[model samples]
Target chain A: MTGYLNIILRLTIWFLLTADLSWANIVIGVGVTILLPRGVTNVGLLKDWLRTLGEVAVAIPQAYKEAFEIMLYPHREETVVLERVKPRRTPSLIFLDIFLITFTPKTIVQRYHSRGWYEVHYIQRRETP
Target chain B: MINILSYTCIILGLVFWYWGTWPLLGRRSVLYKLHGLSVADTLGSMAIVVGLLLRIPHEWPLLVLALISLSIWNTVLGYVLAYCVTDDGTHDVGQEVGHGG
Candidate 1:
């Protein structure tokens, strides 16, 4: 729809603050998105999208809490990343780590249950010895 | 040249995050699922990093610090996300490449 086109155009302008082929590519991307809108665009992409939107509307508080935990203490976590590394239970800790990492800016949950050792990649080496 | 690339990346990333992903997941998607980051995550955040790298003044330590944290998290989140998307006993029911809705 025309509404989508207008939004893309504005984004193009934002990118154009610096002049280069990068900007040109960005503009082209915007134009393409406008011309070929898909997925849950236009509030009518699918029934699933609507259901998802409603669910997300309800999940804000939990998400916010998780974000808070990750941000407040980003230093190396005290908990063992893998059970083999330290003999603690994992389900709860791994779940908490995942939620926390997702919201916080510096950390992320990389992989779980790989070759019998839980693994993750950190953006920084704070936790690594 | 850097400025241009950075700005272009920022715009592209923002579009996918705000317009592209927002409609499907709404605000919840922003929460960072950590399972499968989606192409949007890396593309959008890298755009941000490139854009910020171009404009930031050396005196603005606070801004740089914040942006640094953001970029790191984006990468971590995306790597986790990709794992989750392709992990065992699960399947992407909707919105993957080369598939119909």
Candidate 2:
């Protein structure tokens, strides 16, 4: 199922790039997508996948909000903190987690330790009081 | 109505671009600057693409693909950059301390 989805995604990009729908184009798109090397499939839980997608959706709005906040208050303090990664997460899920974290303006993943900890760099508005 | 909205989006994206890039001139750490750059560049570029899409509905497929790639590629590139810089900084600090002692 995932393999088919991957092929479909690649073909979609191919068609978009070429902006064509002829039979010849379809055949060529399929050939290219199939010939591409596939990554190791780490079968992650469906629930986790849904959660990651939800996070991605949420990140868009959150990103806007954070951008506004940063623009409003430019004074900030920076710190490095270690965050624990959920156990048994697939590599793709982990990549999604990192992406979601870094998508916002105030935090970024600096490193992923082998022991399930992410070295996260954070920014916070400094109070003027 | 669509013309006004697209123009608004394009202007908003330009503002984001400026806001994000302005930090590079400040004395903040590299990571802080990167956070601003990545967030602004990705969101701003997406907004601009969306504006173009609204103006030219016939190019929906290409604009949508641009949006997808912008979000994913920018985020991953930011991560890779942050990782590389910090990794190198730590190694350099270690070497500096070794030489100092």
Candidate 3:
């Protein structure tokens, strides 16, 4: 009885969170079928369900943390700009570059010139851990 | 004349988007993406601005002000993020000085 109730509750929460019924329904349907109503008590499914909740809510904290970090960081008053990087031959990589640059706090994208290079200005270099 | 300019600007903006998303952006290229965004975010926005301006050229002041506000916002956002990296250094100073074994 408890296992049945868990599935129903999980289904409800999942539905509530995802407004896209068709897609969500399909996924939940397949997932439940694979796991089965009997295996509903399995810790894996329960763990995943809990994690999904966190992912939804954790975005708020993540944003706050990023913002806080940004504020507390010491940025030089001077602007360090990178000149346009002309990628020879293969030029279909601008979006990746833009997202990567914007995603990194240390780097700032200044401008992309007609010459096919993006100008980057950074106060400090950051290392990936 | 105004319509032509609007279409032209929009097309140019789309071109920027295409370039930014395609050639300018890709994996293994952080600088490219940053540069692409600068173009994609600006020129793509310019497309909308031109369209609006063409529709109501008299409202150019509003567009100008909007541009200014957006520029300020972007600048602040960039600076704020940079500040985060800088603050990390301050935290590390004590650790390095206290225990350098």
Evaluate all candidate structures by whole-model CA lDDT and list the values in order: 0.43, 0.80, 0.46
Taking the tens digit of each residue's C-alpha lDDT, what string does model 1 give over B1-101? 76777678678667645532443453323223332243245434545655776776542444445444454456555655546554453333212212111
Residues forming the 10-long window of minimal summed lDDT in candidate 3 chain A: A87-96
Q: Residue A98 error for model 1, in Å?
A: 11
Worst 10 residues of 2 chain A by lDDT: A1-10
DockQ for each candidate? 0.07, 0.34, 0.03
**Of models 2 and 3, which has the larger lDDT?**
2
Displacement of the residue A95 alpha carbon in candidate 2, Å? 1.1
After best superposition, candidate 2 residue B86: deviation in angstroms?
0.8
| lDDT digits (tens) for residues A1-129 of candidate 1 | 333324543454444433335767777766765666454323223344344335434543454343334435433322122222223423433343344444333334335664444433333225344
DockQ score for model 3: 0.03
Candidate 3 local distance difference test against the native? 0.46
Candidate 2 at residue A116, lDDT? 88
Residue lDDT tens for model 2, B1-101: 99999999999899999989988998877888897897579988888999999999998888888998898889888889889888633622112111100
Candidate 3 on A1-129: residue-level lDDT in tens?
234334654565444445346976869764874465464332324444444445435533353343334335533232434345534312223433443444333446544445565444443224212
| Chain A TM-score, cand. 3 | 0.36
Better of 1 and 2 by lDDT: 2
Better of 1 and 3 by lDDT: 3
Q: Which ten residues in a row have the lowest lDDT in candidate 1 chain B?
A: B92-101
Best candidate, TM-score-wise?
A: 2
